[model samples]
Structure formats: C-alpha cells, structure tokens
Target: MDWDREARTGLPEAVFCAGKTPAQIDAILAEARAAGRRVLLTRLDPARRDALAAKEGLDYDAASATAILGGPAPARPGRIAIVTGGLADLPAATEALRTLAFCGFAGELVADVGVAGLWRLLERIDAIREVDVVIAVAGMEGAIFSVLAGLVTAPIIALPVSFGSGVSAGGRLALDAALGSCAPGLVAVNIDNGFGAAQAAIRMLSPRGGTAQNAGPS
Candidate 1:
C-alpha cells in the first residue's frame, strides 16, 4: 500500500480485491489498522466480504462489491450525476456512487434513463444538467453515452457495463460504441469500471488541489 498516495495524488490508494485471498485481505486490513489508516476495498465479492465480516469497521456493499475499512471521507464540494441506461446498469452505477461516497464526493443516481425511452431521459435532463460531472453507464450498443454527452454541458465519462447477451454479451459492443462516439470531448473507461469513472470525476472536481486527507482510522 502506498500510504502517501492521498498526499501525492490527491486520492488514497484503494485495494482491488478481485484475485486476493481471504488471508491476504486480512493481512492488508491488519496492516491498515496498525497504521491507523482508512482504506477502500473494491471488487470485494460477497464470499470475501462474508469471510472478512469479523473485521471491525468493515462497511460492505454487495451490489457494487465494495468495502470501506474505516469510514467514508468527509463531504466535499462537488456534484456528480450518474446516469444509467437501464435497470440492469444499476450495479455499475452503484459502484460509481460508492466510490464517490468513499472519496467524500456526493453523486446523484439518475437511473433507467436510457435512450430507448427518450422521454424518460428528456424528463430528467434538467436535473442531470445541474451537476459538475456526468457518468453515463450503459450496456448493449451504448447509445446513451453519445446522447447524454450531446445533451449535457459537463464532461461525460462513459462506463460500459457488461449486462447483455448475444453480440453484446461481454460489453465489447458497448465499449466500442463509447470509443467510437462522435460526441466531442466524450471519454470512456473499461467495461464495468465504475471506480475508474468516479476517479475521473474526482480529478475533474479537484484539478488544482486534492480534497482527500490521510486521516487516522475512525
């Protein structure tokens, strides 16, 4: 763990828990505790979360597969809007929201506003326009990315979710769509990388200074 990441990059180092074993996670948590640090764990599946539940101060969210060891950072100044193409994209959106929360930034989830139902997204356009940054989550062809980017003035971060079958099975189609989008200034992250999207928003929110502090464990 790079303990001084928050001081150097304006964000703390987060543990990616995809391939880590239970004992390894335990050791990391133990080290963090000894150092009196606040840590965020991403990609923490349910089984791992259950195994580590005994650790005090462990806050887990199964939907997004995320955990916070100490606690969320204090609220900071920034408004983020997370828009999802459909109900199936909620998991990815939730991850972005959780990341924002852990980083001390607040985000509003605008769910199920895909281009399939143009009226639904149009209805919420005003609210989505009020934020400093926008994260658009979608699977399938990912037309929502371009649509939202064209509609919103804030920078758009397209998060392609792996939530479809057939040709769109693993989100490659969505990823390609996001990459090929003609919308100017639209950027994209990997498939289902909500954490990355949130980090981009954080960078945009704090371009000059880092809002996060390396505080002791709560």
Candidate 2:
C-alpha cells in the first residue's frame, strides 16, 4: 500500500495491534518509524507498550489504547476531527487521530460522546463546524457517525470497532449502523480499520491524492 500518500497528504501510517503477536506489531512499527515516520498503534496490549520502553520518542495512552511515535504532531492545512463514544473507544479513536497527525493534518478529537449524551456532542458544535472533515471511531451501535453526519457539514469516516461481546457478531452492529446511516455525509471503514479510515480521510483532504513519493505505507 502507498503509505507515503499519508505523508504527502500529511498523515501517518497506522499499526493494527490486535491478533498479531507483540513482536510482529513491534517489527511493523520499526519499519514504519525507520522511514522517518510516526505511527499510531491500536488495540495494543499494556505489556506490549511496556516492552517498547527501550524506544525513545514514544507516547503511550492506556486510556486511548494507543502508542504514538516520537516527535511533535504534524501540522495540517485543513481540520479533521475524530470522535469516539466511550473511553473504551478512545484507543481506536486515538489511532485515527495519530494517523491524521502523521499524514499532516492537525486533527482534533471528542471522546466519550456517544448518543447516550447528545449534549456532550452538541457542545462541541463549534469545533465540529470548524473542521473540514471528521472521523467517527466507535464500537457498539456506532451511532456516533450518524449523529455527527446529521449535525456537521464536514464528511465523516465511520469506523466499526470490534470491542463488543455477546452474540453481537464483532462490530457487525456498528458496521450496520454506518451502512444504514441516512445522513448523506457518512462514510464507513472496515471493522477496527483506523488505518484505512485515516488514509481515505487524508486522501480527500490532500491535493490530488498526494504524490507517488508520498504513496505506500511508511
């Protein structure tokens, strides 16, 4: 994949930390960072982050369940907001945010703002309106994206997280919700596919899908 498109678009490469062994995740991260790129690791285990302590310029977020590569956030020409439901959704949400930051967009996030508390989302209306695009990182019903699409002018990238238990077939509900979104602006990504969502968002924001030199995953 053209990971560098994110760089051209001013976004970062993302790591999927689920299912894979810690060593695999770490190695993948090494490749990305070695190319002078920052990364966002999602669904990473606590132990995994601990093992990576030897690495400098790393920021770990237990709440967000993410690890951002070293260095300051990248600057963006347009605004992209990432909204998540509960604290549990933060890990995936942060992954999206880091992707945007790595890709070159100054991204923003609104955490714990699911439909249960519409007011919380309403309060951020100003911030939502200011952004050019939005990435909704959620599990469960994934209604957050629909709500955002209804309320904001910006396009929304809906991510169905695979965090729910029960007969509730792994993010299927979230995916269905996104697919059923009546709002014209809602776009859905794969289940727990923050990398895909971020790449798509950045491509739309970037000029002409960015240059080939900036293509491919870093």
Instruction: Please provide TM-scores, in order, for all candidate models, with all chains considered together.
Output: 0.94, 0.75
- Tens digits of per-residue lDDT, candidate 2, 142-215, equal 87888888888888889888877774458899999999989896889988777678778877787764643544
Q: In TM-score terms, which candidate is top?
A: 1
Candidate 2 least-lDDT 10 residues: 209-218
Tens digit per residue, CA lDDT, model 1, 63-177: 9999898888999998999999999998989989998999898899999989889999999999999999999999999999999989989999999999999999999999999
For every candidate, C-alpha RMSD to the true structure in Å: 3.3, 3.9
Model 1, residue 72: what's the lDDT?
Answer: 87
Worst lDDT run of 10 residues, candidate 1, spans: 209-218
**Pairs of residues at least 3 apart in sequence or in different chains that clash in candidate 1:** none
For model 1, the superposed segments whose C-alpha errors exceed 4 Å read 209-218
